[model samples]
Target chain A: METFKHLVNILAHPTIMLTVGMLVFLFFFPPNDWFEKWNRRLRLNFLWTKKGFYFVMFLMVVFFLFGLTDPNFSLIIKKPDNVPIIGLIFFVFIFLWISMNQALKNDNLIEAGEKPEEYNDPEDKVLVWPDLVYIEFIALILCMSLLLIWSIGLEAPLEGPANPAESPNPSKAPWYFLGLQEMLVYFDPWLAGVVFPSLIILGLMAIPYLDTNPEGAGYYSYKQRRLAIPIYLFGWMILWVALIVIGTFLRGPNWNFFGPFEFWDLHKLVPLTNINLSEIIYIKWFNRGLPENILVREIFGFLIVFGYFLLLPPLLAKTAFKKLHQNLGNFKFGFFIFLLLCMLSLPIKMYLRWLFNLKYLIAIPEFFFNI
Target chain B: MSDKKKSNIFQRLGESQVWKSIIRSGIPRTRRQRMMSVLNSVFLHLHPVRLPRHAVKVKFTWCMGGLTFFLFLVLTITGILLMFYYRPTVEYAYTDMIDLGEQVPLGIMREIHRWGAHAMVITVWLHMFRVFMTGSYKPPREFNWVVGVILLTLTLLLSFTGYLLPWDQLAIWAVTVGSNMARATPFLGHEGPGAALLALGDINFVNIGSDVKFALLGGRFVGEAALLRFYVLHCIGLPFIVMILMAIHFWRIRKDGGISGPT
Candidate 1:
């Protein structure tokens, strides 16, 4: 049991969890068809099948039941504010399973040179008065009943009165914004809070514009949009939902990590000797006093930041994203690549923070500017 | 005999001037009548007279969009009820929350409102996920998708603004942490990147007294003013904006050819 707890704790770490998420995504959606035969032989694609879904759900249920037996895990999971998050986790998985299951089925049909399931639907048109309206009415009633039950079962959280002086140990934002709060750990408030959020909204809005592919426009088919689907899943699952989970359950006193079975000890100290790029260059590597001039001091950091945003787009267009560039033209391709790079930067920054204890790429406290 | 009499009475009532004036098309019993029923009613007209059968499939759409709207309506209704007993002032805000939970009749209104808000957030996300997976945002639906993204942001903002209304330790701190991000709003924030550059001969334009954060909080910190501001945004300002955007979103769905289907 102790060993099991330790293993779970290790797996729960953001680095490990994200690595696993990437691997699983790759396993399910292999980049090349050459891996298909190997995957079939290994029966790995069974994970995307109905039986696999049920098996995974069973495992999740068992895990939850076992975790609930542990008081520490139960305490966190049973919290009023955390309850919706628990539901969110289940809902995300269930919905993902449902959509993926259908997509895979549709993919199979399309591969056999047949129309997708939606195309074969017999009743092409339906009356709004009875068909759609009936569904809407039923859904509304069902939703209302569910809300009533949920409200009755659990009381909304009401903590102590507002006292500015007395702060909570682990002050968390609302569950939805927890992802942004988690990002604050790695990036400055400007980048994490303001810039990234705007980019996310912009990127989502830009999807229709960027994705010029006419295929898979109105149906579920993974094979038709292998690239698009996986990228979206990665953003939604790992970047957004997983971060929320980490922020809600793992983050404890002073925003320290606490495993599900572990106690949130206030005094549990982890060494944090975060160094900026300028400090690393001047003080550590060169073994000299830092320059007085701000621009001169942070020249290396500035160069790297500029190179990443400015140079990388054209470079990537020539190399990795050549096909994408050809498809989306110049302006659209540039915008798409920029957004993609920005999205990828979050994980890159996180990895840097974990591996090197690096704080800011460009840290200029003179004007409170850091990245 | 009694059942016949009741039916006759209902039929007569349906044919009466008041009922005719209100219903226009009473008890739709034919195909044309069904279509007319949807067309004639203001509430029902939001949906088209006919839809692709697959569009009504629970498996495909997951009814997430409808549920999201339903949850929003629930939130609005319950929010109104809660507002009757709740006060936004710092002194009364915390006490008012306590009273709603403890003293008010049907105190569950607060719970329903809170949970409904959370549910709405989840449903909206799922709705987006569904739309993306189905590739419904393609072609003519592109602008609608952008509208949706804005709605998603507004939904989050609505929830975030409401988060401070309870005036509890959780509320104030969370808002403080959230609003603190405004302090780094590039050129606008006091501690932001270009704020220093905005200064002229030691006369700094952006500082603690005049920054985005100060504007957001109505002061340097999350106090009474901040609470009131958040309350107004939560209750009126954001919702009003959301309603306008939502109108465009729904209208565009019809204009863009009613939900996407297999091409």
Candidate 2:
């Protein structure tokens, strides 16, 4: 009884202790030198690249950075309209980022004049009949049996008839769309629900067309198809999957934030004051009352967002991602960078909303548009 | 001599004209016979007549796409069985589900159908992921990937429409939330965009009654009209589209020269 109570108390209060521990450990650690030494010890000389060690260190930083939060654990990220479940997201993001970095390094090496690999017959293959078909059949049987067993153990969920009057608290979409739902916390309906989803589909469909790297065609070779594969994987693992994880577990009553272990309360009414960016700039900064026309007010916002996505790509091509730009050419580079930044803006906008109550950069209620 | 005359009945049947006509080629003695064995049967032809050894390797393919297709077949069979009992009405829908589960013959079929729908989505995702991981989306296979993406969209849409059928809170609210996302569709959505642009005094071009969500629901909100439309889409319309697309996807795979692997 005492131990159980003690465990519960630790769970409830472990937030501060963990934050302190992670911060202290990070402060003392010499990440660069450690990664350098790690390359030799692990002997990633044969297959994997030395970039992997650096990525591992980066993962540690990412892990600890999120760990030192207000929540009792790193997995829970509490905000008014979002509670990001970080566990799976963290793991997946780390995997993606590191794998990408490693692949990039390896590809760079290969590009700078190195042998692709040994001479082996690419067409060497066995018969597909009994080999593939029988395996598929067995897998089918196994899956069906497993599903049947699971069904027998746990029945499918069915709630009472829906009453429009008595709405469920913190009414959420299906688990898959939870990321978008989470995004709704920081973004307008048009941006979060419609624009981003469309963009994601478009981006996915456009991958093969946009990516010109022809090295890894019929196989999985990180070195050959470094840029394309890593970028796509990173987007998939971090942006979509992570957001869904966050939405599913951390979002509680009234879309208030809650830790994974925390219980949902119907009365957890957070007195949130979400202010539009235009409101702050106009009403507070300029000492103006309010604009009668939404379109006029949203003009500044429209320019800013459009300008950011469009202008920033060329600027990046000239500077930070110079190699990428050089490799992909002008059009592809601009397009790729635009998509990347747009995807990145979700998290940025989300954090801003949580930290500073930023509802929308551009709020045009008349047009039912917000950015 | 009498014993010799009385040959095995099975052997005699095997040699009989009735068996010969059906069997076509006797015991598949040659390579041509082996090919004929596959070609002659409608069921066997769904698979390739021959395969590269690499194609057979379980590690290479993971069989997720095949499993997803199989699950779709399962959903179709179970869903048809379920439809015999389920009545899509405000008063009857929920009760019909309950009746299907408890009072109807083989009540478990409904549960399987419900679970199978969920499984199909998951399998499709895994299959798509596998394709991406293998870098099979490059060049000649690029259009196939697009087809795959469309199939994926169709799968999600089908699931979304089906969510409202049970008339339970889970179904209704999920659909409501899902459909609400459509309301934000730029230009075409009622409240989204172009409403102000296209409006001419008393006539708003885009509205709750005319938009995608409205068409999807067949009303202002989820009601009887929505349920009927959803039922039609889930049972007939979406499935028909999905089947055609799937046929294209498979044929493209064959045309692309069997399955992709490390080369």
Among these predicted structures, which one has the highest lDDT?
A: 1
Contacts from the true interface found in each model, as a fraction, amount to 0.87, 0.58
Tens-digit per-residue lDDT, B176-227, candidate 2:
8778877778887887865557678988788778888898788888888999
TM-score of 1: 0.96
TM-score of 2: 0.80
lDDT of 2 by residue, A127-244 (tens): 3344455687799999889668655654566678867667687678766677788778777677788888888888888888777776766544464554565466556654667557
Off by over 4 Å in 1: A31-42, A120-123, B1-13
DockQ of each: 0.78, 0.44
TM-score of chain A of 1: 0.95
Q: What is the Cα-based lDDT of residue B65 in candidate 2?
A: 91
Docking class of 1: medium
Residues B98-145, candidate 1: write the lDDT tens digits: 888778876799889999999999999999999999999999899999
Error of 2 at B22 (Å): 4.7
In model 1, state the lDDT of residue B24. Answer: 85
